[model samples]
Target: MMKAADLAAIRAIITRAKRWDLFFSLLGILSLMVGVLTFTVLFVDMAIQGVPRLSVDFFTSFPSRRAEHAGILSAWVGTVLVMLLTALAAVPLGVAAGVYLEEYAPKNWITDIIEINISNLAGIPSIVYGLLALGLFVYYFGFGQSILSAGLTLALLILPVIIVATRESIRAIPQSIHEGSYACGATTWQTVSDHILPYSSAGILTGVIIGMARAIGETAPIITIGALTFIAFLPTAPFAGDPPAGLFDWIFAPFTVMPIQMFNWTSRPEAAFTVNAAAAGFVLVFMTLAMNGLAIYVRYRLRKNIKW
Candidate 1:
């Protein structure tokens, strides 16, 4: 039989472990609290200073000057155009490539080379993409610094991210789902489209949304690709003008987007421009927040609708 003293010692050892676990838990909680508090303070400060300057004119009219500067309308429109066209250029192709690689591609040296290149492309700095666009669109192909040029650059810049995201989303579907479909004599395409795609749709959308948020904040690549700080006209259909020249008109034609405009406003010598910058910053923050909120909503719905 064990002695009472021995029993007491074992209990003491277990008690000591419990204390250490509680201490670490307390430490983790404190760290989280500090992070939350810091974020709150910074966001509150920005909002306090920024809310007053955010007016309808700030949204509707073109930037005029100091107190009287009218709006961010043109910049907002350009940013939308850039993002939309970029999405058109990147999404379907990226998703299709991801689907093919994740689903159908044989693992071979050629495929391995492509995979390696895709991963490297993801890590390449955005400015490098700008240079690629500059060389291809401006100097070599001569697309000019137009909206299409910026869109094409951003499309390339975001492709790896979207492809990686799409692959992950597809991979998350259960293999059993595919096997079951196959047992039912469903073709591979039908099984993938009907069963796998819907289940992973939310995750894929989330990844795209997150990627777009990052793209919206980009400046260096767009600048390098010859996105101008100011443009008199809104971007319409790309390649509508007389072409076949250097196509410099294609890629190098001057364009502007919100982030570029904000950077320009902030760098000006005038205080009014600085104010416009802050206001623009606030708008950017809002847009980013909305995108995140959408991702969260989509994720929630996905979880809710999915059955065991």
Candidate 2:
């Protein structure tokens, strides 16, 4: 129905549109390259300055008043302990809430309200979470300035992310899978546990790892919870000694994490401490990268194994 001139005009328009799309795509790739390059340069610089300082002693000894003798033993140990607590607190609750919302909750105004609140919570500033922890956990609940307080604060911060990730993963499972399970005389719990959870594990794990990576690097919330910045001693052992400090003693102990330790070192006037900060930064970056890599590997393996 179109004449030759109109056909040519349409072709020209499409050509221009494709040209613009290609131009924008190239621009976006360039931007990504720039970011990667910048991070590479910074990482290289830090490695040069800090790698020489790293030794077995750096991991074995505790923080010292003298920069030459300072180490991150307490800092790293507290970091691990806090992260363990965060995982224990956040994962089960987040997963359960997500499962309930996606599978059991009725489609109603209450569900909509809950969903909206979660979406808003995800966008809230980390510092605000810190303040809330300070008020509720530290003061109101009598958690004190302890690892438990810090861990719980981070748990709350990452809960929304985990819930959303879980819900999305569950949603991705084909409805036919559910129907087939029901057709086989499977209960709702059995259907979810057998079909939905196995298929969604990869996505959920990826989200959890990402959330934890973010939590490890967080300084504001822990600081607000009154985490000590100059700890030189590890928390009381959970299960060692003639009479153990009790399994929960460490939770109530004062602690310092790698991020806060790095921050404290960076704030000092000495060049040596600055170098220490760089080394700690390198460790933290390495940890975060390892977590992300694990998440990627898990997703790849799961996707590969399950064709659907």
Candidate 3:
């Protein structure tokens, strides 16, 4: 309803705001420069220390006397298995709980309590969760210092991450989809399962993957549950033996993981141990970056493809 003259006046005022654009651009460019430079320095230092130590034994042999000994085969195997198990245990439960709370729960006190606690839990120091795992998995029920204990501790540590990610994804869903499903006479579960979930699945999965990546890097909690620095036997499948090491049997067996092994090496009296430690650090960094990159790529595609 504004007159042409009025519109022209407003446009003139808006054009005046562009005068500060250069300042903002300079600030953004400077910030980016600083970040890149800092990371470049770190990468250079790590590479200089680690690349020379990268050898056949670094990947193939068990830890030995540094220059005389090589490889981290056992620690590598343990870390992968524990991380995989933690992911397997965390993703489904976290997503399901998120979905139920977001889509099905009455907006009541109990639900609010859960929502608040889950957010709060994410901020709790991971080492505290390790203590809880120690009490519950190692002492109270008697699983003891095993890979199972590490996985469970890690699962708890990452659950909050998964839940928070899932909840945000579910919350991001457009309400119109829910209303449309309701209009079509779908049951609450059906609307959530067939429509709402499919719409937000990509986001949920991305969050879970990020959570898993963080869990894979964690050392404090797993250490609290007593991840051994040395385990000679490669882990057999939990239920593959003659007695089929019952869930409790395998879950409580003493085990070693990569981070713990690195910690042990770093504490040793030899310079070779320090070099190997750096190499292991590089390996962890590379693996984490790879997983995070995949998650980001997936998120970009999902955002591009999803309607909302």
Candidate 4:
């Protein structure tokens, strides 16, 4: 019913709007490209500097006073051990707490307070966690400078992250799933175990991977717990037959992780150690990327398989 002139004006306005939308879209793409380019440049630089240092001996030798002789054997082993301990300590507790909060906790002021505090904890600085670990795990609890203490400290740091992820994943499921489980005479625990947990497993795992990835790169909390920067010897193996430090002695032994070692190298006056630092940094980045890739794969598989 519009006049020709009015219709033409309307078309012109829509055309202008579309042009602006296209402009913004291209701007966003350009911004993303900038970030990608920066990362690629840095990665290529590190590869150029560090790839020559990636011999088998580099992975098998211990730290030394000489830059050429120093290696990351102790550092990488300690990193893996600390990560195992952190996972054992954090994952179950985080997942359980998340489940309780999302599925069981009554909606009340206390619950609201708890939820708010959890979210706040996630945003708190990592150094504050280090300070707390220094006070409680290092001094009060007297775990000393052992890997056990470091693991527990890192566990506390990542708990909120895992809980938040679990809750968010569980929340994504339709309420009808819960209703149907209940209609079929499933109890609350049964419903969660059989219906919610299974469906949310992928999300929970992604969160755990992300959390552990963060934990592996943490330096402050481990350092605050009095971890050595120059550890040159491996911890007693969990199951060394000859010396028999027992199955759990390694957990109680002093240790150093890759991040701490890399930090030490980067601080050195020598130029060669800088290359060592770059190599260690490359390893850390590769590990983090692998974990992230696993998370992405998990999410994709779950999304593809699960209808709802």
Best candidate, TM-score = 4
**Ranking of all candidate structures by their lDDT, best first:** 4, 2, 3, 1
Q: List the residue pairs that clash in candidate 2.
A: none
TM-score for all models, in order of appearance: 0.83, 0.91, 0.85, 0.92
Clash count for each candidate, listed in order shown: 16, 0, 3, 0
User: Cα lDDT of model 1 overall?
Assistant: 0.81
lDDT, candidate 3, at 101? 81
Off by over 4 Å in 1: 1-23, 65-67, 236-253
Distance from true position, residue 232, model 2, in Å? 1.0
List of clashing residue pairs for candidate 4: none
Q: What lDDT score is found at residue 63 in candidate 3?
A: 64
Question: What C-alpha lDDT values do all the predictions have?
Answer: 0.81, 0.91, 0.82, 0.92
- Superposing all C-alpha atoms, what RMSD in Å does each candidate have to the true structure? 4.0, 3.0, 5.3, 2.4
Off by over 4 Å in 2: 1-26, 239-243
lDDT of 1 by residue, 182-263 (tens): 9999997888788877877788898889878888889999899777776556544454655534523433335678888888
Predicted candidate 3 versus true structure: per-residue lDDT over 14-43, tens digit per residue:
877765687788899999999999988877
- What lDDT score goes with residue 54 in model 1? 89
TM-score for candidate 3, residues paired by index: 0.85
Poorest stretch of ten by lDDT in candidate 2: 299-308
lDDT of 2 at 155: 98
Which stretches of model 3 miss by more than 4 angstroms?
A: 1-34, 237-250
